[model samples]
Target: MKENIDLFTNLLEKKYGVWNRNKALFGTTPYGKVASDLSISSSQFSKLLYGTATEGMYERTLNNINRLIERQSIEKAYEETQLVINKSKTAYRKRIYFFSILFLGIGLITSYLFDFNHFAFKLSDYEKHPLKSYFYPESSMFFDSPFIYNNAISENCPCSGFEGKWKLSESFKLPLPGMKKPGLYYQAKSADMIIRCSNLFDSYIDKGHGMMGYEHLKSEIWIDTKQEPLVPQYFNPSSKVFTESFKQLNFESDPRFKKIADLAAFNVNMFKIHGDSITRNAELTGRLAIDVNKKLAKKYNIDIGYIVKNVLGDLIKASCKTTFNPFCNPNDLSEGISKISFDCVYTINEENLGLNEGYPYTKSYLFKDQVFSDYLPCECEDN
Candidate 1:
């Protein structure tokens, strides 16, 4: 445990140099605040930058300190990236006025044509034709990163400006009569990430089939940050990434069309999740969860997927293999958090390892790595 800290500190010192690292931690940061909270005379924060241990130290202690340091370190990096992404957005400020007027005009046309009454729009024109509908094959499993699951991630990784481990030392407690005991986390380390994405892609049947559907996939990636790992979450809580994406997506689409203009209005929900405060994420979570439930998908009107077709307009045949964030600390917002009690595993280091040992977090540490096979050729076809 402490040995890991030594390596972490060494990496930090190497990046800034001994003189500068000490000056940054001591001179820039308020000295005794963190140490006081832990009731230690010496700065436990020092363990972040200078302390050494010949072998691993206490498991719980290391996790507590490591998560703290992890947040402090990468939060700084994300702040830096935020700055870069911000400077980039200033260039797009001029285009907003031009699009605003264009949208108003298109909105008038779309509301008149695809009005609320057309909410039940008919495809009679297409159904009467021989092609009937264009069948959009399902999308292949997607990953924001270029590498396959379990591939080692680095600073160079795409879509993830992350590379660190997160550990929650103990279960939480409050000033209540029946507070839960602390949790022991022996297996928190940097490893593969399981990304639980919902409603990222929606597909609808076209022509006369008259059907709409939604789907979700649980993809895996290499390493994920301890702070925040959800790819869509990059926009959540509102970062410069959100604004850039807004502009890029609008600019990419041909907004001159009524369909495109109408979509722009609703698609903003995806953007809204990031714009709204984290506490408001309960709404977004409920919405995304519908992608998994067949009935809920119907109720919510979540039908939206890009359709592919051949020149004659038959749904292009494409092969797809099968596959499988949250808010708060995500741990706090997790289903597992609600189930915890004082007598659960938090009380005894090795108590009944309940259903969700790695709540708000993920898989425990083990020698054997969780693996996923690369996609192989398939004979999938359109029915």
Candidate 2:
């Protein structure tokens, strides 16, 4: 019994990278650390490492080690089999050369009359449609558009401007928690556009799709402003000199607008928009308003009520109109811009906002208001 226990201890030491001489001398301290690191219980580790017990525990530990050793042995056997097959093939080739020579005289007569090339003939037809032309009939010819190719871009690739230079526009700011200042800003101009988050552009470029749906649009915009503007220039036309708001700024509350506002508010929070004592509190309050408006819109599905109750009623009531400054007053002014810089304001005009130049500034039917022809693809059926 003692000998059997000793044999097991020796095997454990050898298999676990410990010398047989040191197995008995090294106590549970070293074993315990290894066990803890491996996330195994100390009792199981001690029994396996020390061989201090007998019965069921001993058998279990021995079986575990035996299974590991058996796996190694099986792998070694597979390697040996592959080696034997390689050697056998080499020997067979040597024998085949001698056998071929012995049958060479008879093979020459048989090969002369039988031509393999004639049996496998093909004709080149350049006039055929390029897609239909095939070198081999059995080969696959199915191909997909290069633009929507899935493997063309990697999904895990980081965003392009994530680490690049970005400047915040002055007029935009969202309130965020624990921020010393407003968030950073960035814009994606048509020529300057880079694929970063998703492959929407590739699909749009290939298929002539005007733009991806709202979901795609959602992922593309990333705002990191210190105080996300209550009314961003992109969304607000009243602040810009040249740009016009969607002709119907009725403020009649659409549920969709609340969702948009909520999304904007969440972005403000995540990016930490508020800068200091003056700017910080109002933006945060505004973000809360935005969030409340969103929840109310979602719950009631009546955005007009939400806008009236939350923004027009709740927010305006809490804010002091007397202290408001379009420039210095953080809460009163738009989040992204202080009143100082003119360029801080983003406008809808093609000249001011270089990003949306391709999009029409005015409605297609209202082109008489401006001389510029609609460059955006017309939805009209007739040319």
Candidate with maximal TM-score:
1
Which residue window of length 10 is worst by lDDT in model 2?
363-372
Q: What shift in Å separates residue 375 of candidate 1 from its native position after superposition? A: 13
Residue 315, candidate 1: Cα error in Å is 48
Per-candidate alpha-carbon RMSD to the true structure = 22.6, 30.3
Candidate 1 residues 1-383, lDDT tens each?
Answer: 55566555443343333534544453233336534533344544565435543332332333334334444555789999988766765547556667888999988888787755354233211112111122121443442432223433221121111111112223221110011222111111122222221222111111111111111111111111122222253233333133333223221143321121010000001101121121000000111111122232233232222110111011001111111112212112222231111111211122312312212211221112111222222121233
Candidate 2 residue 223 Cα shift, in angstroms, is 50
What are the TM-scores, per candidate, against the unseen true structure? Answer: 0.27, 0.19
